[model samples]
Target: MAADITPLIHRVRRWPRRVVITIAVVAVTLLAVRIALPYVVRNQVNHRLQSIPGYTGHVADIGIALWRGAYALEGVEIYKVSGEVRTPFVRARTIDFSVAWRDLFHGKIVSDILVEEGQLTFVAGATEAESQTDVDRRWQEVIEDLFPLEITHLEVNHGLLRYQDTTKTPAVDLFVTNLRLAATGLRNRPSESGEEFPAEIVLEGDSLGGGQLRLAISAEPLAAQPHFHLSAKLENVNLPELNESLKAYANVDVSRGKMELAAEMAGKDGGFQGYVKPFFEEVDFNNVSDENKSVLTRIWENVVQGLAWLVKNKARDQVGTRIPFQGRFGDPQVGLWTTIVNLFRHGFVRAFNPTIEGTVDPDNVLPTGDSADGEGVASEKPETPPKVATDDVKKVEPEAAAPTDQPSKKRTP
Candidate 1:
């Protein structure tokens, strides 16, 4: 037994060197992989981007996160090489693609995408060569190739949506800045409401004239036909700041005023219903100089000013009209007489409410029949619930705004 103890001591001494060598080899392998992963991803992404038909794209850098199973792309830019427009079509400061943990918990595998400081520009001109609308590009294919997982969540922060018209006298450049958007539940996951239309999207931005723009949509993205509920609102827009665009398009100019607009649209089974309500407060067109003005132009301006003055609500000092329509998607019919009557009704009767009227509900609309046959059935506001003084009845206010109908001022930092 004493002789065997000497052999055991030698074996124990050799074990430490073997373990050290094994650890050193693993450490070197992992270090090499960590350095190489980003290079491989960068090359693959750039190749996919350039494969799009009419666009050229490049990525400045790529970063990998092994623990989270995510990657980030920096300085991604896509340009239209075929168009006369010099500005890039799409540009992003950073884009992150990662696993959607919330959906994963629900037994669904999907991906989440976040884009920061992104810009999408559109150029309008007379010919096809002058316009850069991305109509000819297969950008969706590129996105599908880069990320193999199904996208369930998307977010954009501090974005810009820009439009440029070169055909006009003084090239029109309009943009919405500080834009934020979120789209979730694209794959129709289960929800508390258990509604058929589960996908929800929200968009908010600041327009060129200091207007706050907000839009919300609830949709069934995988439906056979388009089905959705949408509400949009733009408020406190200075009218004079948009004179160039107005004068170019409408042949009208406003010296002073602020405008607020609200609308609701619902589409289901190839049919739709909606109304657009516009409010103008303290608008004026009479301050124009008489020089270089034709007689017809002067008469037209005076007529426009008189009509607004005549129909404006005295209490609110706002002129507004609700133009309602409902019909098949292929051919829509506007309620011309209803629009004319609303003008008088808005001024003589109660003023049109400067808020979203939750009258358009896709579930309430008839999919087929007179309602969907372009018969011009007017959408009605929810009736006020009868008040019961007794304790047995609970009072419900139908006019109360829903959370989705209210314009949110939330901005991403």
Candidate 2:
């Protein structure tokens, strides 16, 4: 019985040894494939890139590497020649991408594109400008021709954005830092009828002091129309710094308070309608710069001064005097009058038009009264005659007749 059990144990042991050997062989094979995969994939990538009509230069230094079941890429550069391909839109910098071989083999491309370090530039009018209808048709064609592909992850670090207006000589530069983004279901083709891969983008920067901003966006792409709906919120922005960033614009400055905004937009073919609600606290117009002050002054003189004068006169009549009123120094057309009125109601002005009719305190610092120190002179109201009592009229009538009878003898002057 012991010998028979030994035979069964040997059979089981033999099966375990075969399993180990098979695993070892498979491991060696995987190792060899990993070592050779980079070269093969790199060559394939080079050939595919060169085949594009506009590809000019290509260089791949470090090959692909697979470690821990993930693919890694290094040392890749590509340059754009001239091309008629319209898929990615503009033909600028077509190279400078590194990706995992597995992603490419799986028909999905996942890579971190270093756009900030690359020299990517765009010439907007290089292609002929078309009418809105034509543009829409072209966009529809492009969307229909798009192929399905996946992008697991994407990141842009320390990116630089520069724009040159068609007439401007110098380009405006902006820097974006620590931009981390991730996405899923990013396909060139629409998933469902109007489905798109959901995406979340986060951006942060300290270029403006105490003016950091974070924005989040999510959108779904539409079929045929290639439309997208997006929502974004900007937080913790110092409006003063933002205004300074817009110094290139002629007469613009943030007067007072920071700003936070939230908005949503959806459409296609460069047409969209959106509402932005901006919240401001402790906002004032007197804090604006000189240039902006001039603009504000002109607007006030033309559009608001007449209204203000009327208010000042009415207030004087109610208070029986002219009170000291500080007029706002911002664009009156943009609800500055309402702000001033609110400030007046807040006791900043000595006299303001109150809902309750008739007379304000003359001693109020606003336009109602003259100052005790003679610093301000109050406007005087017209005098009104005193009213006589109706009953006292009869008492004076008899005295009037007696005076007439005596007057006949008293005329001996």
Write the residue-wise lDDT of candidate 2 on 1-413 in tens digits.
Answer: 99879988787677877797998899999989877876776665556545544443343432343332333334334334454322222222212334546666877554433232222233332343310002234433322322112343445333322222222222222333222233334444455445342443444333332443344334444334323433344445554554434333433334544544443333333232222334343333343345434655456534433333333324332211112221112211123444445434433345422211112122222222223334421222232211211111121111111111111111110
| Candidate 1 lDDT tens digits, 105-187 | 89967899988877888999888778888653266568878777888888887778889898885567777777778887776
Model 2 weakest 10-residue run by lDDT: 404-413
Per-candidate count of clashing residue pairs (backbone under 3 Å): 0, 6
TM-score of the candidate numbered 1?
Answer: 0.79
TM-score of 2: 0.41
For model 1, how big is the CA root-mean-square deviation?
8.6
173 Cα displacement, candidate 2 (Å): 1.5
Give the clashing residue pairs of candidate 2, or none: 322-367, 323-366, 323-367, 350-365, 350-366, 351-366
